[model samples]
Target chain A: MSAVGGAAVPAVDERVTRVNPLRRAFTRPEMGAVAGAVAVWVFFAIVAGGNGFLTLRGTASYLEVAAELGILAVPVALLMIGGEFDLSIGSVIGAGSMTTALLAAQFGWNIWPALFVSLAVALALGAFNGTLVLRTGLPSFIVTLGTLFMVRGATIAITRITTGRTQVGNLDEVAGYDVARTLFASSIPVGPAALPISVVWWLALVGLGSWLLLRTRFGNWIFGVGGNTASARNVGVPVGTVKVILFMLTAAAAWLVATIQAVNFGGADVLRGSDREFFAIIAAVIGGNLLTGGYGSVVGAAFGALIVGMIQQGVVYAGIDADWVQFFLGAMLLIAVLVNRAIRSRAMGGRG
Target chain B: MSATVSSRVAAPAPPELAGTTPLLEVRDVSKSFGSVIALKDISMSVHAGEVMCLLGDNGAGKSTLIKILSGVHPASEGEYLVEGKPVRFGSPRDALDHGIATVYQDLAMIPLMSIARNFFLGSEPTRGVGPFRRFDLETADRTTRDEMAKMGILLRDTDQPVGTLSGGERQCVAIARAVYFGAKVLILDEPTAALGVKEAGVVLRYIAQARARGLGVIFITHNVHHAYPIGDRFTLLNRGRSYGTFAKDDVTREEVVTMMAGGEELEELGHELEEFARADGLAAGRLGEVGRELEAEARG
Candidate 1:
């Protein structure tokens, strides 16, 4: 024991202890996901033949399709890390797409205006969910769950009444359609394969989310709010504000995904984004964002999305029933959650 | 202990009095919550380099007084003076701005946050421009490690969550934070109540350290035994009223205990215990039985 500033020194226990335990646990999710990914690749390669499963063409196809889900999962992961849920994100996508389609196709608005209006609407919807949750002090799960259905219903009713159909198209005629297409639909050539523009957004968002989660004061507040709201408040971290900001970010991501999908397909479907929120959440949890909050990583979440993408693509590559992808994902989600719980327990010294 | 006290009395007054200026002053502050009078017409002063021990049992208005001083709740009557000037606090932040920091029994710390993160939570250091602005991780880490080291806490890692630290270590961290943030007065609320013997000693040493740094420390604790050893002045409260404030050299530990127990109540309890012992006539070891009798008397 040694003294400093006249304060009594704490005696060192002299007990053998593990060093860098947190670093080990913190990177565990990515390591596990990466290992799972490689195992999946190898399994598919053995079964589907190297040319069919391990080719650059196959990898590019998997990454391109995974890009959209990855883009949405990044912010969803952030929301989960902040200790909240956004079950309405899928419907927010529907709402944003409908807003863009209705404005551009029926109202003859330019794509830029339509996009702005749609994003603004998405922001408002997010703020509404946040306000209700904050005021009621209810779990965000129930609040957003109710909003999911309400938004879905409103999208269907409005689309049918305005267009006499459940779908809207003709967005290609809008000004800035070329810009939208180039950003959302265009592909970048990588050797013999091309990667969709969505992959760029996914990678960019992953980088941004990682930076925000690990290198900002806002990031610290997120962990504080999730870990212990009472303590965070006592220290003046503005818990409510942090939660509201998370919800808004989720909605913004929803809008971005909706824009990409609508422009790439040149239409909007009432059922365009159903069940995507669950997928994003599963991806986040698998990536290692604790469902209970306080411990998680954005990079891990992106990896979780990559795992899902690989499975979705690998099921087809191996000539397995594509329907089995959902079952496989469901099983993987459960196993990931269980493993995360075990790792979390060990890291926290077995305390809840 | 008695001999130590006699020697302390024979020694010259501590060097703390050399400055001869009160750092914080409460002038007849009174507060009431609706129908309940929580605190009434209390006055106290803490000078730099002095530990002013506030002693009371539960519900003795200790919490109310602390809340007023920490600006959690304002006084409904009387005035609170800092540096001999009357002032009112709008919130805890205002008190903090005035260099008054309160460390409650339940320390305000996010248990899952890293020790360095918790140390610089609200006022994190950042580098770069807007959007590019990022946390100054190296500075935060170095400063937290240095500050903890200054407080005699050599953590093996700065990135470990504070939840892993012992109760005493957590208190030391909070105290060090207040001192580092330029707090002139530190108001501690029962910091050692939940700690073990050794942990409590660690905290008491920090209190002395803070006093030595010329910071006024208000130490609230129910254990007169703990306070008697480190206190420069003692103020006892009973049933929301001040018993009296005394300079440490003027009162003995036993006298302080007697005052806290209410001498009349203690006499009545002693009589009852004696009656019970006489009626039973089945003593379980003389000293042990007497200690139990005294404990029972104090409870009454």
Candidate 2:
């Protein structure tokens, strides 16, 4: 290829062949997640025999849970790849649901306007977290952890003050509720099963996020900043902008999941998304994203969410104690991390 | 002695290229941070198709000069010029806009990124429009391979992480990246300090190659041997001021080495060592015998 834009003279080195295709395949970061997802699916299918655990109905059940978790996991993966964390994502979801509920049910606003205001608030909080991190030069983990408590407390206090309760309901009676519910929370029928609309949203987000991380300039900036912030800035990568935008993206995803749940159930409780941020992070880690940052795949994170979702319901189908879900999830997380580390080393051509 | 040294240090320019304007010139520029002056009245000029060797020990204002030239810091006094036109740069990006790129000693490349990705880090080539616009991966991979090959660095795969590359290869990649981005003046900081003998040779060859490609190169280093082979002009700095710039034709490698070492300082150090040894020789102990032997070896 000739140099584009008269940039540089192209040289004459034409040795373009993969040294070992098999090795390359095993080295990909997503391989571990793909394997983990398959393993969980099979294990559940075998233990829950005759329970239709492998059927379309059973698949939909797990997929719905996976879809909700996946929605947040994909963006959280991106944020981690950009070398930041958002502990505030779970709180953002609760706040979003509360904002929509408070606005539509208490303030008597239209559902559409209330939804918009909720998403805007989520975006603003994300920006606040980003700005605080950047301006203070503090770790995002600490900043977002602080936002987590602040948003959670505010959500609880506001709901209690206005509605005299920790929960808001009767959202279906609000204006434009029908349209919002149909668009965001309605399910579609498949052969032998009905699927949640959130599942479709999750898959769409996964595809979009994967394309973004693998194919875009902004994606490169995300990797660059995470890998080496000083080097990235020296090359004029606009590290601060990329990071803030990632923070906002995670918040937006949380808001979307919150809207789907609020519309689907017709109400929201204050504790709707408690401890879910850790689940999202677990999925991302299982997906091969380094906790240290700079490396990951959104597709891998989707599979990670699927594994969590499978175990969440699979334990029940297999007649195991419900509390075993946490135990299994913790074990899966550990295995995924170790397996991902191995794949990463192999991807670096097996260097330490 | 001064007159003899001046005559010996007079550089002769090739007749055809004598009158061209330098690509970058710092005219008596001075920089100070608070009460501390980092550099003062330092003047140097680099022409296209020539490598300007900036030689200095640590804390000798080399970094300050580089920062000023690359627009990381503005000169506290005097003029910084590009193509004979005086300019003040607000940021490194502004300096880059004027075609001056600084390849720092740290290389400014993300080690975890792929070769193609690192090659096109800031100014990525994109195809399509709007949301469909993506990093032109095929082009990026191809161009990265080809440009690196042009610098005599042939990688097995452009998709390989840059961290896997050797130090020499990494430096070459940084140089090639700067050149690909249309850097008219490429300033490299200590490009060979951390390299082996063979790797140092490789970097020196590329410095000369960059000059041959019509780019003005400022190769900063403390190693005289590394600089002596590739540099067209040598400017030595001591305590934040230039001794003087001398063309390759006018200065001997021996003179450059002695100047770099500071002859009087070496003599003073030798005398101090002798006095220390003599004072220790008067001590009547086993430790005194070891000191005498070291002193004898020094004298010998």
Candidate 3:
């Protein structure tokens, strides 16, 4: 009544709430993912500890892989929670890396300028994907599927036309390469471990994402739009904008990941991020985001990535067959989803 | 309030409408989809603190009329007035802006979202300003608690998902939410249709509570028993046309039910059903029995 915010006002003093705090904590979507990550680490520490899997160096090696994938997974997870798929991210990565390399290496542009242009291209592609889905009323799965092929095809065709090769090189000679590399590809000394700077980007993005979904109004609209789009529209939620923004964020993340890879290697490949879209979605699912949308956590996606990172590195440390990596990823995803389903049902089953 | 109709049965603007103007009114409204007419020549009024029941069978133009009122669709021919002024709403938000909120049968609440979140939905309250602004969860939870309590529901927790609530409880939540958002006129579409007897009773009580808070309610339903008690006036719609708007004082329950069923039409339908029964041997026993009953009821 005092705020003039609207007709609805909370007294802010009626606190006879009835939910148990402990039960509430257990129902977090990411709880299973965090537990699974720990479990995987524990398994590897016992089996491959002597192989330096428990060492600081080994941790850094796995985390480096996790961080890059996490950057993409986190945004993909947010988009998934909004009840849409962005399959074009893998292609966006390829397109972005090619753009970065073509400008910096072939055109002799500064790395920063190349990266900015690359980012612009990615965002435009994202907006295009979002707009097509909105206008056509097609499932983003189908729409982005078309974009995935179209973007990949365009990137490859352009690369061939420009250089007559799938790979581009000589980016190390570009201006601003040193600063760009320091920010994106360089390592931070942590005790004995020189952890990749991408880890920092990954963690920061996760934190920012957590804040957005939990604390921000846009986060509510994301859930509203995904949960029941027609209902959200009925109540005046701008459903189209929320979905489009999510699509753009995923594309931006793809650009970040692709830029990091290209700068680190001083080159780019037309097929750089071929299957990373599935990897990001896998991490998201393992992190506790529902495929149906309306419920998820970015922190969960981080743990999901951690689980993935451990498995990718742990197989080599433990001297297991590399062929088992895909199998483990699939198994982990299935197990995490089962756990999420249980948690979801429990959370929804209110006391009468 | 169960007497027969005296007069003023089919008047567009009845002479008895007194003092304050109705919160929402429609005059000679008609809606047509392509070549088919869904509703024609329908007129209704809902004054403050009144429950005006729109009673009709399935396919009786009830949904069409509700859609027009809620601004989902415009009537091909009609004048829609809110607060005594002619208004054309481009969308449901425009209707809500004019203080006309419609609680659809679906309830429009996200089942996976907590009751607090569902209560606010698109109209989330935020704290602070600009990029730092945030969805104030504490405020939403508290408001949901207060509003649900006002509707006589002691929720176990506002954090509980709405999908877990019973049908009646969900209806109450939807209605309570509409009221909390300052809806001057509430359009409830078949709210009690999917509910159990006890759940229906709970929803009916909440509808009464909403009316008690001086909100005009348009309770649309096919059930005569549900509407006859709480509804201040009855508008019977049949075959895309209104039989008449009757005050409860001028109509008994039996008379209302008979007219709503169309006694003369029932006699004709019964004869047709008997013919079908003779032609089809498999369902003849059951179909013949139903047809005989229809004939008896119509004749009586």
**TM-score values for chain B across all models:** 0.89, 0.87, 0.87
What's the DockQ for every one of the candidates? Answer: 0.26, 0.42, 0.41
Give the alpha carbon lDDT tens digit for every residue of B9-43 in model 1: 32122455645657788867888889999888887
Writing each residue's lDDT as its tens digit, candidate 2 over B1-300 gives: 234445654343434457988899888899999999899899888889988899988888899999999887889999888998999998778888899988887755677789899999888899999979999988998888789878777666777788777788888899999999999999999999889999999988888888989999999998988999898889988889887888887777866766666644554555565566677675535544554554443332
- For all candidates in order, the CA lDDT equals 0.82, 0.86, 0.88
| lDDT leader | 3
Q: Pick the candidate with the highest DockQ.
A: 2
Instruction: Give stretches of model 1 more than 4 Å off.
Output: A1-32, A39-51, A349-352, B1-21, B27-42, B74-78, B237-244, B255-292, B295-300
Please say which candidate is ahead in lDDT: 1 or 2. Answer: 2
- CAPRI quality of model 3: acceptable
lDDT of model 3 at position B263: 67
| Over 4 Å off, model 2 | A1-18, B1-18, B261-265, B271-300
Model 2, C-alpha of B49: deviation from truth (Å): 0.9
Which candidate, 1 or 3, has the higher lDDT?
3
Q: Which residue pairs in candidate 1 have backbone atoms (N, alpha carbon, C) closer than 3 angstroms, thus clashing?
A: none
Which of the two, 1 or 2, has more TM-score?
A: 2
Number of backbone collisions per candidate, in order?
Answer: 0, 0, 0
